[model samples]
Target: MSVGWIRPVSGLAASQIVMDDRIAQAEAPPGLYRLDRNWHCDRIWLQVRNVLGIPAPRVYGWSSSTDNPVRAEYILMERSGGVELGKIWHDMPWEERLEVIRTLVGYEKAFVSANLPMHGSLYYAKDLPSPSPSQFLDSVNSIDKGETFVVGPTTNRAFFDQGRGSVEVNRGPWPSLNEFVHSRAARELACIDKFSSYPGQQGLFSGPNQYHPTRALKVEVLGDYLKVATQILPTDANLSKPTLWHSDLHSDNIFVDPSQPTRILNIIDWQAVNVSPLFLQARHPSLIEFEGPIPEGFEPIILPDGFDDMSEETQHQAKNLRAAQSLYKLYEILILRRCPEIAHALHFRDTLPGQITGLASSIFSDGEPILKGMLIQLQDEWATCVRSSIPCPLSFTPEDRTQQKRLEASWSEGVELMHEILTEVGAYQGWDGWVNHNNYPVYKERLARCRENFLDRYAKTEEERSQWIQAWPFEDKTHSPTSL
Candidate 1:
C-alpha cells in the first residue's frame, strides 16, 4: 500500500526535493508517498476514519501490473501541519498546553461514542503454539492425555482442516465484560492447576511438612487480594461497552498545534488500539505520565465535561488529566485484584523494599500523607485477608507459632518504619517538600539495610532460596537528591 500525491504547497515540495537530492534523485512531481502493507494500511486508515469520524484519505485506488503481480494500493490526503506536542511543550504557554490536553480528551470521547472497540491482545500463561485450533487441541491433549479425536461432521472437519491450521485462538474479540470475566476465570483456573502439579524434586512440596515451591504461591496470594477487589468492579453493565483505546499512549503519539490552540492531533496508530472497557482506556497511566511535567509556558487545558461539549476540531485533545488520575487509582485497585504480585512487585520488592519505603517518606514530605498511609492500610488489609482465608492450625508446634508471630511482627515493623520516616521528613519539609525534592539517600540506606535483613532471614534456607530466586521482582534505580 502507498500514499502518493502532488505536493499541495511549496514547503512540502522543498522537503521532497531535499530528500531526493540526499537519497536517490528523481525528477518526478513534488509529491509525498508512503509504502506499506495493503491490508494493514487499509485497516489502520479505515479504523481512524470510523472512530474519529474523519473521511478516509482519497485513494488513487489499487493496481497490479504484469511487471509487479502483487497488488498495490494507494491513498492521497492533504497534509495537516502541526508541531508534535512533546517538542513544543516547553515553548508553549501553560494555557495552551491545557487546551491541548482537553483536545486529546475530546478525541477519546469521540472514539468511545463511535462504539469502535480498542484492539489489543492480553498475555496468557498457556504454553499453546497460538490461538488456533491446533494449539487448542494440543493444550487439551496435554492436560487430558487422551486420544485426540475429531468430533465434527465430515464437511465441517474438512473446512476446519483447510483453514489456517496454525492460527492461535484469541480469547477475544471479547465484546462484553461478562465475556472477559468468564474467559479469564477459565484461564486462571487452568493456570492454578498447572502450577499446583508442576514437577521438581527439590520443589517446596517435595518434603513432608514442606510448602509448595511453585510460582503457584504468588498466584494464590494474589487471589486473596482479588477477594477485596470485586467490591469496586463496575456494576453498571451499560458502561462496560468497548471503546477505542491506545494500548501504548506514550508521549510521542501526542501532537499539538500552536495556531489551533484548542485543538490537538493524534497519530491514531490502530495497531495498538483495542476494544475494551472505557475505564480501561481512561486508566492507562501512560496517557498522562508521558511528556513528564506539563510544558513550561503552556497553560493547563481544562477538559470539556461530556461528549456533547466536544468539537470535531478539539475532541481528541481534551482528556481530563485530573479525572485520569482518579481513574488510575481505581485501575490500581482492580489490577491488584487480577495480578497483585505482578502489579505490586513492580513497585515493592523484597530486595528493594527501600524503593517503597522511600516512596512513603516522599509522600509524607510532600504533604500527601495519604500516599504513604496507603501502604500501612494495604499491609493491614493483607493481614486481615490472610487471617480470614487461612485458618489457624491447632496442631502447630511452639516453633511454628513463633514463626507466625514473627511474620506478623515484621509486617507491623515495616509499616512503623515507613511512618517514622515520613514523620521525620515531614517535620522538616512538610509533605510537599518530601515529594518534590529529588534526593533520599537516608531512606535508601535504611531500605538497603531492611532488604539485607530480609534476605538474611528468609533467603537462607534452600526452600527460601529457591522461592526467592524464582520471584523475579523489578528493580528501581532512580537516584534521590540526598544521594547527590
Candidate 2:
C-alpha cells in the first residue's frame, strides 16, 4: 500500500492520481508530488492558481523547459481528491446548485480583479509566441481542427489588431480593450471569405455554406453588414481594460466536495484561459444550462416570499431555469453599468448569426423560420439598446427583399434537382463513414477527374458544373453536367 503524506495545516494527502497522457503522477514524499508531463506554456495553470487563490492543489515547483530533469518538465504540487462536480450536478438539490453558482460567480469576480495590460492568452512574458503573422495563424489553427475562424489560444500580441478589410490590421498585443473588440470583429469578417475558400468547406452542406449562401451577393453584403455593426460598438476606456477569464468553464473542469456540492475542491485545465474582453469571457457554467430553449425578454426569476414551502422537484426546476438566466442577467448588468461598450458590442454581435441564417435560409430547412423570427427580435433589441439614433442597418430594403425572394426560387429549384440526382445515383446506401475514412485523398482525386469530365462534356465552365458537383451526396460518383 502507498503511504500518504499529510500536511499539518490542511491534512491533505499526496497519493497516486491518474491524469491524461499530457500529465502523470510521481512517487515522492507526502505533501509534495510531481507532475511528469511535456512542458508548454499551458503550465500557466500554476500561475492561474497562484493569482486567483482558488482552493486548487498548490504548486511548489515547475519546470517549463524539457531540459530540466528535477522539475521533470512538470510541477510539484499538493493533490486534491473530490467528487467531480459534473457527476453530481443533476443529483444536487436546488439550494446546493444555487450555492455552487454563487461560488462560481465569486470565482469569476476574483478573475476580473486581476487586470492584464493586453489581450491574449496567459503565458510567461518570455515564453510568449513570436509576433509573426504565420506563427500567429498557426497558433490559432492549433487550438482545434474543425473550428478555424475563432481567435484563441495564441500568445502573439500583434495578432489582435483588426483594422478593416484585412484579417489582421497590425501585429499587436492590443493596448486597449476597445481596439481588441474592433480587431476581433474585423478578424471575424476577414475569416468569412477565407472560410469560404477552404476545400473542406466547398460542398453545399459545408460549414460555410451552412452559415451563408456560397454566392457572392450574400457573402459580400454580410461583410458590409459586419462593418456597419462594428462601428456602433463601445470603445470606452474602462471597457477596454483587459481581464483574465476561463473561456471554457464546463463542469468537468471543476471538482467539489462530495458531501457539500457548494464547496469546490479544485478547478483544473487552465490551458487556454485568456486575458481578453469580459463580454467574451462571461457565460453560465455549462453544467447548469436548462435543457430546453433559453427563455427570452430577460425577466429575473423572482422567488416567492413564501418561505421554503415548495416541493423538491419544483424548486429544482425553478433553480435550474433561473440559474443560467440569473448569471446572464448579472453579467449583463455589470457590463451595462461598468462596460457599456462591451455590453453593446457583445449583445449586438450575438444576434448576427441568426440574421445571417435569415439572410441565407435557402441552404437548410432546419429551423430557418425560427431563426428568422429570432432575427427580428435581435434587431429590435439592437435598435433599442445598441443604437436607437442610427437606423438599424439590418432592416431589409425593398431591393434586398426582392433579391432574397429571387434567390429562394433558384435555391429551391437547385435543391430539388440535387435530391433527384442523389436518389438516382443510389447514394443513400452502403456508406456510413464518408467523412471519417482515411482513404479520402484517393477518393478525392477520382472525384476531381469525374467533375472535370462532366464539365468538359456539358458545361461551359467549371464554375457552373462545380455547383452541381457540390450538390453531389456521395463520395463515389461520375455523373456529368448533362445528367442534371
User: Each model's C-alpha lDDT?
Assistant: 0.37, 0.48
Question: Model 1, 1-484: lDDT tens per residue?
Answer: 1222432222122333343233222222234332222223343444456436533332223221213322222232223345555566645665665555454444445555553332222212132223334212111223432322111111111111211112222345454455544333333334334333321111112222223233443343334323333332344443444544444454444544667744654353333344455443443435446322343222343455785677865565444444444334444444455434323332332212222222221110121222223333444454342344543222334664454455344445434544544454342322222321224466545545654554465565777666654531212422212110
Which residue segments of model 2 deviate by more than 4 Å?
1-44, 56-80, 128-171, 185-212, 215-219, 235-240, 293-397, 404-484
On lDDT, the leading prediction is 2
Report the number of the highest-TM-score candidate.
Answer: 2
Deviation from native of the Cα of residue 57 in model 1, angstroms: 8.7
TM of each candidate vs. truth:
0.39, 0.53
